[model samples]
Target: MNFDAFITCAVTGSGQSHKKSDKVPVTPKQIAEACIEAAKEGAAIAHIHVRDPETGAPARDVALYKEVVDRVRSSDTDVILNLTAGMGGDLILGNVESPLPLGNGTDMAGATERVAHVEELLPEICTLDCGTMNFAEADYVMTNTPGMLRAMAARIRDCGVKPEVEVFDTGHLWLCKELVDEGLILNDPVLVQLCMGIPYGAPNDPNSLMAMVNNIPKDWVFSMFTIGRMQLPYVAQAVLTGGNVRVGLEDNIWLEKGVKASNGDLVARANTILSAMNVNILTPAEVRAKLNLKKRG
Candidate 1:
């Protein structure tokens, strides 16, 4: 618990948070600027997700990803870039009348299309959702079957990029282990992210958190976070559980009650807490070294 800690600020998620809080970066330029600000505020890593410049919705276009990567790389900030490879497969169910094909606004694609940006941009880290689950209140579903995960893992391995396995529940942990066992993913200190309190997935509770943590392989390097109001409390919980912390507009939009948060404000608040607890907040370079991640080419 007294070990050095690192915080990854998920600057802008590929979600509708932009409308909820203006602080959520929309375009590539805005995202890059937020990353720089987060780095200055003490975030070791910037977890990035590109949005359609016009609509502020999630976009899997390679050009958008390239621009964001270019902007962040060109900036003076020294934050580790962690791109998202977890898009392009959103299946929203429709009524029986139009159930034959997916309803409008449903974006589904092959595994190759999902990782196109990862292969092209070659970031040091990328996220791979280990499993799928029911989404929000709508009839939407996040579908990532075992076969698809294997294919994506093989491609990520070939690219020599570290895959940050994101586990939304216990089943996902089992899937991550399967990937590791199949040799698609390398062994020892597997990178796992315990994503708590994300609609229809695991609830944000001590029992749920402990269950997921207990299931993690002892040799794996792990981090955990919750959404919305639970963000700050989950930080303390994750640290107490001996895992890293993740925070940003992606998971939450407010810094506190009635106060919306900027990406920089969230990171700054987490850093202040870390310092107060006497934990040495590691830098981006330190995180890369610890995780055995190579710099992007």
Candidate 2:
């Protein structure tokens, strides 16, 4: 396992969990504040997902992203900003009775439409979900085909931003390799984020985690995270596998069973674990240099 590690706190994700916990930030101001708090708690990076203020639903408005970026940039914190380009692909399938068209709640778009926010508010790191899958109990499908992923990657390259290829399964990793092979992704130290223990993706077992780690290219920079109870376990697992770690309310809402956690609590917990293991948690500048990410302009 590598000694140098960095913790990334995903402040608030674009999911249907706003009502589940009041800690999840819904407005742009609230989200930026959450990032700041996480940074204060020793997180080197902050992964962000914007939502509508009133309804607390996921939104793709460029202005919303602009506000978020502006607030974080103007803040005292120096956390590396990572915006989500994983929106705009929510496809809810209808029941068997009416499966031809999309369901009534489907909110999806094409590749270019998915990344409209990233184009405008070009953060240092933006996520490109490598593949699609069923998201929890939702009737929707998170769609990201090879063609769409390639297009999104090209756009991210054009924006002079690094794309953290988010791999939810082995097949998604294969797609990431395909992107590299096709030259859509610039050949450098690739950044891959292994999303474990999702509803339909890879499980959070030791074998599954190691299988994914073993398959990753040696030169690739990777991070790992799991949801709910497995969040902290994956932190140690990720560190043990010579990779960085990601933790926040986006994946796990609770610090303990039935105890909802804030972003700061999650970062602090990860920091404690890393420190106890004699691993130095990286700072924001260290992470930026390690990932070769340009500071947000």
Candidate lDDT scores, in order, read 0.88, 0.88
TM-score of predicted structure 2 = 0.97
lDDT digits (tens) for residues 66-143 of candidate 1 = 888898888787988899988976888785466656677788889898898888989988999999898774678888
After aligning candidate 1 to the native by TM-score, how far in Å is the CA of 26 from where it should be? 0.5
Q: For model 1, what is the C-alpha lDDT against the true structure?
A: 0.88
Cα error, residue 182 of model 2, in Å, equals: 1.6
lDDT of 2 by residue, 1-297 (tens): 868999999988977677889998899999999999999999998999989899998888888888988999998789898999988787777775776577876776887887888888878899999998876754668888777888889989888889999999999998889899887887567899999999899988889989899999898999999988889888888889999999998888889888899999999999999999999989999888888888885
- Spell out the clash pairs found in candidate 2: none
